[model samples]
Target: MKRCGVGSKNQAKLQAVASVFAEVDYDVQGFDVDSTVSAQPFSDEETKAGAISRAKAVLEKDVEIGIGLEGGVMQMNDGLYLCNWGAIADKQNHVFTAAGAKILLPEEIANGLHRGEELKTVMDLYTNRHGVSHEEGAVGIFTNGVISRADMFIHTVRLLYGQRCFYLS
Candidate 1:
């Protein structure tokens, strides 16, 4: 089987990529690669940059394709909204990127993020849960489990894959 790499050890992210590439016959694997961005990106641009960085980093592992997923919060006049980005990079260095759905965060969560706390930490405290990021994530908590973090990343990966196929065609 051909190799495809995900630039994250996060189980949810790795699973998302695996599920997407399963029908395509790629041997999906996850790697612990640095995103080369903030631990908690505060804007859509930085979040996308992190995803692209990871995607490119995974290329060093000799995979034909590399994927990266990143989640963050973006501030707007209305409120802070959760943001997610994904990127796909091929050996040719061609990159495809996409963003997932966004949802407004509650004031408390926003405040904690503004106070320099990572979303995973603040969300765990707010929801009184552990490993929420690896599980349902803030999107799941806020959306009442309507969309888990993995589900969100799955959608993002699909977008990236579709974009890649489009460009290839």
Candidate 2:
């Protein structure tokens, strides 16, 4: 099995990517790299950039692969939505990227964000729970546990791997 390192201290995100990697024969590991990522609230580009940033940062070592995940918000004609982004980097620094699922926020939650609260903070307060981002997350609550933050993140990682697989093949 190949070795994989994920650039995140958060267990949920790490496990999300790791679980996906397991299906592809990688021995997964997590690293808490300071990504210094910035989110533009509703910009998919910036959100994806954060994941790319972490993927590159995690390459400080000789791991066969590195993974990064980021959560972002985007506004649409219907409502605002939460988005997840993922990136995978190879030992030579080639990067592949993708995004996870998105959930439209209820009006009330959108209002709170308009009041200047971050998605993490707003979800915590609205759900009467803390660290929603770390656990199942907003997606979990929105889907009544049918889907979760990790699950959504896993989708992105899988997509990234799919793209990488193409080139290798």
Whole-model Cα lDDT per candidate?
0.93, 0.82
Model 2 / residue 14 / CA error / Å? 1.4
Q: Highest TM-score among the candidates is held by which one?
A: 1
Q: Work out the TM-score per prediction.
A: 0.97, 0.90
> What value of lDDT does candidate 1 attain over all alpha carbons?
0.93
Q: How large is the C-alpha RMSD of every model relative to the true structure?
A: 0.9, 1.8
Backbone clashes in candidate 2 total: 0
Looking at model 2, the pairs that clash are: none
lDDT digits (tens) for residues 9-47 of candidate 1 = 888898889889987999999999999999999999999
Residue 130, candidate 2: alpha-carbon lDDT = 83
Relative to the true structure, candidate 1 reaches a TM of 0.97
Q: Could you give candidate 2's per-residue lDDT for residues 1-169 as a string of tens digits?
A: 7888888877788888778888778888888786565533456877888888788888886678888888888888998888878899887768998987788989998898877788888889998988988998888888999998888887788799889989777
Q: What is the lDDT of residue 49 in candidate 2?
A: 84
